[model samples]
Each structure stands twice: as C-alpha cells, then as structure tokens.
Target: MTQGFSPTSTRRGTLAGIAAGAATLAMPRIARAQSEIIRIGFPTPLTGPFAAEAKDQVKSAELAVKQINDKGGVAGRKVELLVRDDKLNAGEAATRTLELIEKDKVHAIVGALSSAVQLAVNEVTRARGVIYVSISQSDTINEVKDFSRFTFHEALNPHMTTAAVAKHTFKKGSKIAYLVADYAYGHEMLRGFKRAQEALGATSVGEILHPFGAADYSTFMPRLRSMRPDILCICNFGRDQANAIKQAVDFGMNRQARIVVPVLLHNQRLAIGPEAFDGVVGGANYYWGLEDTIPSAKAFNDAFKAAHDGAYPTDYGAYGYTGVYSLLLAMQKAGGTETDKVIAALEELKYDVAKGPQHYRKCDHQSVQSVLVLESKKKGEMKNPADLFKVLATEPASEDILRTCKELGFPA
Candidate 1:
C-alpha cells in the first residue's frame, strides 16, 4: 500500500515553471480586486458527473492559495481564489472563463476537471492572454490545431495514459474492445488505444461510444460477449466510468475479459467500490502516498491532510495544488502579473511541488511529468482507504511515451 515512485529510477528534483497552454458556474464576478490582493479564477464542476473529483480539486487549490498568503503573499499581494461552477457544460465553462477575466480580472486560472470544460475555457483564456493550467487529460487540447500559448496542460492525457498501461492491457490477448465516452476526450483516448493496439499486434474486436452521462451499460454487456475480447477497456471517467463497470459486473462480464481503464481517478475508484474494481488495473498521474517519496509532495499533503480531516490527496488534488502553487511562483518570479513576464518566468520555473520533477515544454505549454501504472489490490488486502493500488511501473517523463512538443506538431 505504501507505493513509492522509485525515486532512483523515476528521477527527482523540484518541479519548475511550465508556460503551458491552459473552468465554472454563475458566480458573480467580484466587482473589484483590492490592490493588496491577487485574484485567481477557479472554474470547475460542482454539480455534475465530475463533481466528486472537482471537490478534491477545489480543496487542494484553496490549500495552496492559503499557503501562499500565509508566506507573506506573492510580491506583497495576498492571493485569493474566486470559484465558480461550470456544471460540466462547455458553454457555461466558457462564459465563466470570460467572466473571471473580463470582470473579476483574475490574474490566471487553475482547476478544470472535464476535457470539454478545459477546452472551452482554453479558447477564452487564450484569446484574453490569461494563463490557464488544465487538470483534465485530453491530448487534443494540446494538438497543434487547438494548442494555445496561454494554456499549459498539467494533467496526463490519454496518450500519456496509454504509455503507462497499453502493453499490459494487450498482454493477455489480441482481440480488444472498448466502451468509450462519446466526446473529444473519448476520441483522443480511442486514437491512443488504436495506436498502441496496432503496435502490439493486437486486433480490435469492436468498440462502443456512449453518451457522457450514460447510466446504463447493460445494453453493451449482452453484445460484448460475442466480441470475445481479451481486454475490455473502458475509456471514461467519473460517474460514467463507475456505472459502466458496475453494470458490466452485473452482466458477469468481469469473468469474460480483463477490464482495463486508461486512467483511473481516486474518486472514480471510491465510487466504483472495491467489489467492482477488486482486480482492476490501470494508470494514474498521482496519489497522496507518493508524497512519502517526494519531499515537495509531502509538503503539500502534510498541510492538506492536517487541515482536511486527514483525507489523502488525489491526482486532481495534486493538479489543483501545483497549478495554483506554480502560478504563485511565476508571479513572484515575474514580480508582477503582466502576461508576458509571468509566461517567461513559467517557461523556466521549477519547484518541488509534487512528485518527480515537472516542467513545461516552452514549445507546447505541456507539463512533462511521470505516468504511473497501478493495479487495485483486493479490498481485504487494502491497509487503508487511500491504498487502492500497488504501483507496478513508474515511467519517467523523459521517456518517449510522451511525445515531444515538436512531435505533437507544436511550432518551434
């Protein structure tokens, strides 16, 4: 249960600035920002499919901001977070992003849970020249077609997730079937899976793209048996993922094919319960226990747990903390909140904010960090609620699994 990042192999150091490319609801834009305070916008789902994860995101973000303020604020200006709920609606997300800028005049943004919300907010943040660090993992956001200078991708995307577990997923057999969420993220996930399957000499049996908020997956279970898949990969997250796995178990599909999730969230695991995911194996970007391996991670977690009822951190929580923490660093380095100066500082910034050394590729505004493969142990084997999985492999960001900015078609 004490999963370390194998510091020797994964590499370690303080993470630094990532001028990455880059959330919310209807919270009224604060009419004024006091000269003594710096406001940062946090737009994310508070009442939607990703709500559980978003709560963790907000908690970590708030903690980071408070720490900054406690340490005499950034450049003598207190840090304040203005939050809004986007309801996981892209239109609402974009609107909130604009409000955070045009009205609240937030220096930057941190915390977006869904790819759709992240993408939509990115469009607005970029156009406004505001920095946005995303917590969602959709490779398309970094695609040259949609890449933005003002945005930094902080979360591991589908491509990165694939690098962590595709080989193991295909190890059992060649006939692969997938039930993906029908959206931009699902499309990117499918692309990553297809690429990996082809490279591993695996054949696709069949695939299904269900709606985002789908609750019933019983429809697919009856038909899935004919595919005779060696692996049934579920490319979804939050409630959609939990529901699909639950029904798949009900249909007795768990005994038929190995269930593989591209990237599993802490909240999703809790929602799916131990019974549904007792033997599930997948990848993750971060875990609270990893703080034990990385000093910076421990710094964040110690304070977070002490104040938040001893609850551990999730990857989303890590993203929220790092996103806000790094921005504060950039602002301090820049000595002001001007867009150009902050961006320059972020391009070279590093801090021990989380596990391993994280940095942003100046070319694409994508954070380079490690991706971890994990397998959930049986419930009886778990020593604590947080010890959901055993770390199987830790792939350093230096590996070729995550494409270089140039390879991703980012202009030099």
Candidate 2:
C-alpha cells in the first residue's frame, strides 16, 4: 500500500524538504531540481467488489505509461503515475483525489471505475483546476451544472450505451422490465431504457431498484418472474452485476425472458460463468474480439497481452489505457502540461487507440466512440478460456445516440 496523506504529514514533509534542500546546496542545481518528470494521478477502487476490474485498469494504465516512457516521453520529460485506492466510496474518492492534487501535485488525473466516484473526484479536480479524464459511465456528469472546462469523459455515457443496446435488443410491442441498482449509474441507464422502449413501441411491465452491493437477488426474482416481461434489462455494475445475473438465471428468469445488460463487462462475465450469461446481449465500450477487424484493437491487444502474461484486456480495462494515452498525446501536441493548451489539444485531436477512431465532443466533453453489441457464447462454443463474447454489431460513433447539449441544460 502507498503512504496515506494527512495534513500533519504534509507539514512534516515540508520541514523535511527544507533539511534536504540544505543538504543538497553543495550539489549541482540541475541535479537538485526535480522538474523533469510529469506525474498523473490514478484513483480507483482497488480494494472493493470492483477489485478485479480495478486491477486490470491499473495494469493497462501502467502499460500506457511504459509505452510513452519508452518513446522518450512527451517533449523529453519522464512521466510518473501516482496511484491511490478510492475504496469505491464517493467521499473516499474525493479525499484521495484531494491528496493527489494538494500533496502529490499531479498534473492530471485519469482513472475512475464508478459513476459516483468519478463525479466526486471531478468535483475536487474542478475546484483545483486540474485536468481530469473520467473513464467511468454516468449521464449526470455531462449536465452543464456538473461539468467543467477541465473535465473530459473518455467512457461511454448511459445515453449512448443504452440506446445501442435497446435498439438491437428491444422490438415492437416487447414487454420490458428493469432491475436497476438504485444509484446514479442505474437511474441514468433506466432513463435511457425508458426512452428507447417508448420509441420502439415497447411496454414497461416492471422496474425494481436494488441496493448497490446486493449479495442475494432471490427476493427480487419473484417479482421479476411474475412480471413475465419478454426483455429483462439488468442495470447494475461490478460484482453487483455478477451476483444479480447469477441469481436471476438460477431462478429460471432467463428461461422466460431475454436477459440484457446495458454495459456488459468482461470481468463480470468471467465471474458469472458461461452457463449464466449464455445468449445474453449487451453493449460494451471495448471487447478484445474486435482485434480481428480493427488494427488499433490488435495493436492494443498485442501490447497488453505481452505486458500482462498473455491475458487480454477487459471491457472497462481498455478505458484506463485509452484515457491516459489520449491525455499524454494531447500534452505532446500542446508541447507542455499547461491545462488550457492540453484541453484545447484534446478538444481538436482525433485518433484511433483501441476501438477505432474517437474524439471528445466539444459541448459536453464526452468521448464520441463506437459501442459494441456483444452476445455471450455458450460453454460448448468456447475456444479458449478468455474467448467469451461474439460481436454481433458495432454501433458506429455518432451524435444520434447521444443526448443533445440543449437537453442537458446547456445554453443555446
């Protein structure tokens, strides 16, 4: 574990700095100065239900850092990363982010796994004028009230992800039900599902809100089974998603309804097993299966596998690489770590890193990228332990799936 930051320790560090300065006075000024390194903060839930996903995120991010440093870094300066565990709590996320900024002096931040935790970290970064690229999904963060010039969302929002999933999964007159997580993430996804259901002439039969870390979903299964909807959308994430789908299948819910996940995670799929997720349709930000078609995908997969003992990157894990790589590339284009210049470069820059071409939208700073429609393969169809999903469709990146800036309360 890294050292925990405290106000008293910060004061002690200051005194220690003075003594070190006195000791280093006889040394060369160039050797004494430590301004040749760039530090970016990475805060994620490294010790909670999302630990598996978080571990993959850190590994990919470390790969990005290593790749950049191998290329002599941006403008000849070495890059450093400051990692902290947020524990999946909003308040804890905010506090750790504060330490990253006030204590460690990170130039930018580029890691978050949960919607609420990202928003909490954003608040701290915004107040301090630090550049933050959120790699988590949340529609509320795009609102004008919550967004800032320094904030950029590299992850797909609920609006874009759910629209793609709903279009392909729902049909006319289909009976739909939602098992929501009762948080910002689940609420936003539920809202998107409702909009799509209405547009497609579908009927909403039932909607149930469960707590974030629900261990057992047997109680909710009865109500969902009674509804008998043709489509059941599981609107939870992380370990909650794994347990929900497992219990739902055990209750014979999938026998009657088509199970759909708005954001299908590779880590969650491995946890739920093939038997539980077979025939499950959902949307994903990135899937290793795309390496067959996209050159960028192949490049990322090859590099990540070489670095991580031949293991592939998960759906959300790719965000960690994309988010940090894009930020450093922007800094290189801007020729410095100046916040305004980096933001400008990011706004105008476009590149294909992992999932084909993508760029940040100017209005809300949301990453405009493709959403992959994936179906979990049956156990009999598996070729390898990592080969899980088959890409059914690729919803090309466009503004059609995104909510208009006007609808997000932005000025016309």
The 10-residue segment with the lowest total lDDT in model 1: 10-19
lDDT tens per residue, model 2, 1-412 = 0112112335334433433343345333222133468899999999999999999889888888999999989888889988899999877887788778666767899998998789778766765667999999988778876777888999999988988999999999999989999998999899988998899899999999999898999999999999989999999998998999999999999999999999888999998799999999999999998989899999999999998899999988899999999999998898778788999999997978899999998888989999999999999898999999999888998877788889987786
Per-model TM-score versus the true fold: 0.89, 0.91
Best by TM-score: 2
Compared with the true structure, the alpha-carbon lDDT of candidate 2 equals: 0.86
Which of the numbered candidates is closest to the native, going by highest lDDT? 2
Badly placed stretches (over 4 Å) of model 1 are 1-35
What ranges in model 2 sit over 4 Å off? 1-35
How many residue pairs in model 2 have overlapping backbones?
Answer: 0
> Against the true structure, what is every candidate's RMSD?
9.2, 6.9
lDDT of 1 by residue, 266-384 (tens): 78888778898867778888876676577877887789889899898887777888788888888999986877788888888876587778887677767788888888778998888
